[model samples]
Target: MDRWVCRREKRRLAIDQENHLGYRRFYNVMWYCFRQRGSILSISNSSGAKSEQRKGKGSDRVVAVLERMGAERIYGVPGEEILDIMESLRKSKKIKFVPTRTEWGAALMAATEGRLTGRPGVSLATCGPGALNFPNGAEYAHLGGFPLVMIAGQKPINSSLHGHFQVSPLVSVMEGLTKYAVQIGSVQMIRPVFSEAFRIAQEEKQGPVSVVIPEDIAAEECEEDEL
Candidate 1:
């Protein structure tokens, strides 16, 4: 019995050490990305070259609306469905995209930022599996009363063809977990839907919200006023 007890204690100590190391690594990464630069968000853009200056487009409006709502950074892992949105973020000076290794980590980081800053922290993910990874952290944000906004890119809404491989009812899946959840059907809905989501996330008893923007909707053309 004494030997068994000693072994258990040793195991516990090993687990604690592992956790401490993980936390120390995360903190070091955060220091390099934000604190050392005096910016809440990292200034680095994924594309090595500067993004061309753009006045107005569907994607541009999405970025503009997010900036106007006072979002400084968004965390995400980039994927094809979300490429246009990432491009918009890259072009915008007002908001920075903080890339992460996984969707779950992005969601957790955003939630932590939201909790600390008293604003809705934004997380982005691609459709299907990419978005499926978010619920773990998203549910935590909801239960903890963190103001988090989960923005997911969806498969093209226009396709009626077979093999809508990555397509799933994301809005339906997220509805139960988030205070506000919706799928964007057009460029016109982008601004109002996200604006309402921001309001809901920041209101009393704050929690998480989910917005699913379809690929075609993001690719669609738009005048600035439409958003």
Candidate 2:
């Protein structure tokens, strides 16, 4: 009986010691973390470095040009392919991104806006199915002679990883329904190509126009001259 009691006491003491050591180790680790965090905060505060403006991207230039030319809003259903352009649109003060329930709904909204305002109304769509939805609205604008500008996304032009997957001949499909349809091949082509598209949309007997920008091209850094 005495032996069993002594063994029990020793086990209890051992457990107590282990618990105490664990608590001490935890406290030390927490103290070390707090000290490191304070040092990092002090270094950052003392450095006094001004945050630089983000570099301009092709998507930024696209939004800038549209804002400069008097587009008030762009209507679209966003997708991964157009994420860069959507981010650029999000940062614009003058041009707003108008989310719609469907790509077709966005196209119709743009068409109505163009008809009412007598200016080119812009709509955006992602590649493949998203872009395919615009033809009906484009036809409506074409038949009614309303000025409209439609922008569509494309797979990365430089990538062959997913060759022709989810990629249709957008330019060809859009051509039949629009006054002008062209794919932008590079960041440098954005300004000029869009300028021409806008011009064509406003020309005599105005109709819908389509412009396609590749996912990779839209995310590239824009040259100062291009911007």
Candidate 3:
């Protein structure tokens, strides 16, 4: 009878130890996942120069690439300069554009969508005042650790120094609020900048990335291969 009791006690102790070890392992995995989520939601500068090259048809190319990257919807306020790209997206059917009443609203919606889904969210704005309105949303995404991509129309490169109707140095304004910021002026620079922007926004420390597209450049022709 004593031997039976001893054996039973030993089995109980072994089961208890196994349960304890399993709980500890689960706790550790949960902690690791949380940490990884935080890192993916911020900007990391370690990716190097290869991440920022310009390729394709500048802004148009960017839209195509975003669609290819699994972006089914874009939230933003449309303006004259960005209309062409919007039209293209509409026709593609691969992505749908959601128009917002205000640029700020668009930004907020994009950030919120990104938070809910693991995919990156996109917001668009026209140059000048339109671009200025997005900083608030951008800041929200940055602090909230959401993946967001902001595209803004820019004054022609020639008018960048001078002042156009709603001209603002958008790239400079968005610098601190985003993980990455690029002003797309040349066709050759679009691919690299876009690749980097997507990388930054989706990294382990996810945040916002802004791409400013110059007016003239957006209308320029891109080589067939580049497209």
Candidate 4:
């Protein structure tokens, strides 16, 4: 009986020592993180630095052009493929991102807005299945002759890793639905591409226009404020 008690006490002591060591290690890690808090906060919390970094980016130029054209609202669902553009929208003073539950619902709203305002109403969709849901509203705009702009995000232009993912020849599918459908290939093309699209959407027999931006192109450096 005494031998068993001695063994139990030794096991208890070993467990306690192990727990104490674990606590010390956790405390040390936390202290290190606390020491790094200042630098981490400087990078993450500095809005000015972030704003400066965004000033001449391709995504920012797109935002600037849209805002200059009096675009105020964007309707759609958010996804990983379009995060840079989405972030640009968040930073813009004139444009606002309007979140919706369904892609078709957002397209419908954009269609209504365009019909009422006589300008291109903008809606967004991420690549693959998200963009596929847009045909309902695209068809609606086509039938009603309302000006609508559909901006679809796509994978990096050169990526071959999307076999099971969202990558596809999206512009081809959107071509039949949109009056103008084009994929942006570079930062310098942002202005011309969107200008032509907006113009076409407002022309006689106006309908939906589609613009696809690859992830890499959106991250490129913009040479001008407006295009």
Candidate 5:
């Protein structure tokens, strides 16, 4: 009987020890996960602070508005007229820039994205021929009621750097292909204009909207309040 009791005690002690060890291991794993999560949150906070400290430019504000509007991707062919926008896109973490071989491809991709996602898909292009490439895709989106936003670059409007070279009546052309089309003539108009465009693009009978931004305006510094 004593031997039996002794064996039972030994088994109980072993089980207890095993349970304790398992609990300790569980606690350790939980602590490790907590530490890892803390580190990741701190890194994100630091990066957010850095972005806040960075100077706000027109293109940066434009990209910011796009992020706020929930645009996840921008399809385009980069050009000299949109260098500032390209730089801003490169710095953005929320919205990815997709480079295409041609403006037509970019517009088609954006239209497809809009059709699939049920949100306004964004496309970018330079003035003149690049801007003109959007018509076919824009019309397709407009007719199909797929929400789309088309952004096109232009030479400096405030200066004569390009001297009317490669200029086209882009807004007028796009007006027929999209639900709404306008040119952003001032830095202050970026936020409201983009907001309205996004809103309109998603409204009833959803269709394409077009915006034209000049190179100089995109490169200009934006006021803090504007951001």
Candidate 6:
């Protein structure tokens, strides 16, 4: 009984320490300090340092770009493959996530949010089945003239061509549902794809633009300068 109690106490202490550190780190990131060394320093002087480090490659670049464009929230149903991107968003705190019960509901809510706020509402869905569920809401956004962005997770490129589970030809599937549909197969293609998608959704006819993110590509390590 004593051993168990002691273990419990240690666990509690660890959790408390973690919570304290997290709070301090958040504070520091929100309040960076200018230094004479020609570099900005984070106040907390801990893991917040990592937060100050500029995004170099991969999903980090994507999150930074979204933040730069002033996106405050993302509405979606979490999927297995996109969890890394989700974690990246959580760390940045630039975009809050609104998890919906269904993929279709996410799309509808994104459309409504976009219309009400007059800012693009972003939604994420897993590939294959998830993408299939989004067309209805995409069509509604199109008819209503709302600007929205939907990202669907796709199977890795290797698995995609060889026929893996949940693999589908997303570009062909979403072709007519929105003004633009792009399946990003490589890290080099991420920026152009994002730029074009944003243009299609916000300009021209003002409707949803779908960008299919493959699992392998989303997990790739992006260099800091690329962002």
Indicate which candidate wins on TM-score. 2
Compared with the true structure, what per-residue lDDT tens digits does model 3 show for residues 134-179? Answer: 9999999999999999989876785545646777888899999999
Q: Model 2 lDDT vs. the true structure?
A: 0.91
Lowest-sum lDDT 10-residue window in model 6: 33-42
TM-score for each model: 0.74, 0.75, 0.71, 0.74, 0.75, 0.73
lDDT, candidate 6, 1-227, per-residue tens: 99999999999999999999999998776566424223533345644666557444466767777787678888888888687678778788778988888888989999988899877788888888977888988999999999888888887785535747777888897889899988887888888888877777888578998998888888887766777
> Model 6, 157: alpha-carbon shift in Å?
0.5
| Candidate 3 segments whose C-alpha is farther than 4 A from its true place | 1-59, 158-163
* Winner on TM-score (2 vs 3): 2
The whole-model lDDT of each prediction reads 0.88, 0.91, 0.82, 0.87, 0.92, 0.81
Which regions of candidate 6 deviate over 4 angstroms? 1-57
- Which candidate's lDDT is highest? 5
Positional deviation of 202 in candidate 5, in angstroms? Answer: 0.7
Instruction: Order the candidates by lDDT, highest first.
Output: 5, 2, 1, 4, 3, 6
- Candidate 2 on 72-163: residue-level lDDT in tens? 98999999889999999988899888999988889989999999999999999999999999998899999999999999999988877366
Superior by lDDT: candidate 4 or candidate 5: 5
Off by more than 4 A, model 5? 1-54
Show how many residue pairs clash in every candidate, following the order shown: 0, 0, 20, 1, 0, 6
Q: Which stretches of candidate 1 lie over 4 Å from their true place?
A: 1-55
- Where's the lowest-lDDT run of ten residues in candidate 3? 46-55
The alpha-carbon lDDT assigned to residue 37 of candidate 4 equals 97
